[model samples]
Target: MNLKRFCTRFREMRTCYVGTQVSFLDKIFYVVDYVGAFIVHGASISDYFAYGFYKLRYNGRKEYITYRRYHIIQDKCNVLSNRCLCREKNKFNELFKNFLGRAWIDVNDVTEEQFILFCNQHPILFVKETNGYRGIGTRKIETKKQDVKQIYADLVSDKGAHYIVEEQISQIQDLAEFHPWSINTIRIVTIYDTLNDQVHIMNARLRMGNKKNSVDNFHFEGIGANINIETGIIDTVGYDTHNNTYITHPLTGKQVIGFKIPYWEDCKSFVVKVAKNIPTVRYIGWDIVIQEGGNFVLIEGNDNADHDFQQLHNCGLWKQYKSIIKYF
Candidate 1:
């Protein structure tokens, strides 16, 4: 890491510490989190020992010493990230555009494919919650030809549940080459690797949901499977789009494979490139859309992402994560 550049970034974020300092000690905690590099580099003997409990738990969990493990090691690692939930959508959007360039379609106000009113409108639009998690309140609505009066009324009558619909992403599907329900997405996790102070692609999973399958929220029962970074093929773990057992596809009835994710490398690269630009976010999960024909689209990004799929895949990276909580 370049000390000068890190220092510059650290100083810019320090402005966040300007207000609400009742006293010096109170201010110290606030600044430590905001400017982590300084605290880690210049920690005193007491400060270093303060982190001993966290390090022990995190490191012990990673070592696989279930034979005789201590109680406190896991607690320390769990405290590493400080669980900052304030992912500013505008900040993310700006960072996303910086890396994705024109490839990202902007959806300020409109409707997308799922919500299109008329079949005549072949291509539709879509927008999920800027901060939406788990496919909640996701709508495939047609905004253009809607009776504007009724939609406007909904704002007043409904509980201000706002949504956006843009044109549906269109891509040619190769029937012979691809399977049905092909609107699959790749989930790539990037970690700051606090111990090494380097970024690592921690995990990759495939989230598949087609028009026939509906919503891709894993909690909403969407199928999720692990894919190899070296090769796009799925790992042994597989679940239905609705979080069901590996049953047949309702529309296609094709046997689902426990391990068969396509275009794995392309999806991982798309995420890694975008992540390299967002400097503060040490951890993230990028969702990439692989159209029917096999090209990739940067659908969206997620912070504070889940690790259940990693365990399911038997990839066993949880221990690895347990090993790297010191820096954050």
Candidate 2:
């Protein structure tokens, strides 16, 4: 353990305790529980807070898969997902071309002339770093407002970072109406059981952009709600990073709790096929966008799927996860 980092996190957690109105006795009890969880369950302080282990209702807190344990699972399961084929944006597009459903070009692979043609073809483009996550290093470029030549020059010389430029996706009408500023997506986590040659849909969540942000990543202050895997209906209220809850979108007034995702069965089958295709990468978190006519497109795959957002409703999934993967 890094003592310096631990101290820093403790200080940050202390601020959260006070801000969240945790009483002094409760704070002391939580600290003790946190330390005990760290030693026994390999949980981080943030995991303790994020999983609501400090709350009275979470009596089975030990059943939650904390950050450190999630990493351990990733290490054991994602044997090949860390490779360039999945980790790098350009290579991922090449590997999963059939599902991308859009035109894209790698900055390093295209000449100025080819890039100019790409820009002319798509008025709105999403420029993203090859290995970026959580919406960092991503930009929405409107070709009509900016010079194509300048955009090409900047992309090529942006500190040696590789970028993949792709056409913007026009999401399904209902989702678009809910948050027109960003493309709301479904995050479906799949676990491929090698022993049984089966793909299991472990968990799913509906992520939506809040306050007109360009991305729906929870780290970007977006909201996420639990999706019932079998019914494809959102069953819980949305929650944000700051612990704020929403029954309807604050901006668009769309009801969140009972909204049904379009083409639900197709979405499930789509990811199962993808998971089977990459058997070596046993675990994956897939971001999918529903197109205007109910077709779904792949955004990206995460080998180290997040454990916090899926458990935001104070439900722990460690036992369910273990039963499926049996890694522990």
Candidate 3:
């Protein structure tokens, strides 16, 4: 048994049950999952499960790199199969900044002063690590102060600290028009359907963040809901066992209820356009923000998006995306 290799692989295997099921291999060297899921990925799994994915193997040399999230994201969704080099979003955001136009908060070389100034002007801001996920290092800076430097220090100190500070955009004219703190984001997913060699939008989710919620990620402590793609209305919502939830605003006691996502169509179009630009990545997740005036803005792009939020809720998108397992 190659104990060292087994132990190393065990640490990286995300699913806890997977660890237990395969742990004996560590002692016996059975080489449990050498040729497992097409997309070998690390994700936010409860101790119960971790997701694995991959496209059907074809060709002689190799179709995609092993666990290369950037490479997979850069894959072509078309027959020509053109690709891009910026696997990382900070660079992707920078390279595409001039293309994204003036409305986007200019974020090339970020400075503490510029970030604070923008937050002060915009009322709310989103700070995110470019190469990170699960809302692990995200902070919604609502107010700025001279002590903003400390927050910046803490944020950028993490491993993948390369970040983009964006002005927070709300999604409603009035929450009372639907429900209190009704503003939210829609997660649109596009997958390269390998069986048919086509691209299709698998699912879209609406994530709502109230005043008390730091981030609306369905993982790492945020509230989310499944959205009906065509109607842009939330089919079901509220917190799950993993992401947590509340019946009323825990702080204000305002009720949460059925609400439509603002500017849904435009958000979908932009996601398709940018994913087309990336080309190769078969699966793409786009998080879009809606301004109070109901204008849609692209918040950021996620290459390997967590879709478990789809499954745990039994939102029923598994079959829609299963064929796209070209393992991106």
Q: In order, what lDDT does every prediction score?
A: 0.48, 0.84, 0.51
Off by over 4 Å in 2: 1-8, 11-25, 56-59, 80-82
lDDT of 1 by residue, 74-193 (tens): 343233443232143434555565533222222333344322343235333344454556767555545465544454345334444443333455433422122343345568877654
Question: TM-score of every model?
Answer: 0.58, 0.93, 0.59
Candidate 1 deviant stretches above 4 angstroms: 1-91, 98-123, 143-145, 148-162, 171-182, 193-198, 210-213, 240-244, 247-250, 258-262, 292-294, 313-315
Query: What C-alpha RMSD separates each model from the true structure?
Result: 14.9, 2.2, 8.2
The most accurate candidate by TM-score is: 2
How many residue pairs collide in each prediction?
Answer: 30, 0, 14
Would you give me the overall lDDT of model 3? 0.51
What's the distance in Å from true for residue 317, model 1?
2.3
Which stretches of candidate 3 lie above 4 Å from their native place? 1-89, 95-126, 140-144, 147-160, 174-183, 192-199, 243-258, 324-328
TM-score of 3: 0.59
**Rank order by lDDT, top first?**
2, 3, 1
TM-score winner between 1 and 3, please give it.
3
lDDT of 2 by residue, 1-328 (tens): 5989876786576566436566778767777877887787777787777765666334577689888778766766777535556788888899889999899999999999999999999999999999998999999889888898998998898877989999998788888776788999999998888778889898999999988999999999889999999999999998888767899999999999999988999989999888887767777899999886668899998887788877878478888888876642
Backbone clash pairs in model 2 (N, Cα, C under 3 Å; residues 3+ apart or in different chains), count: 0
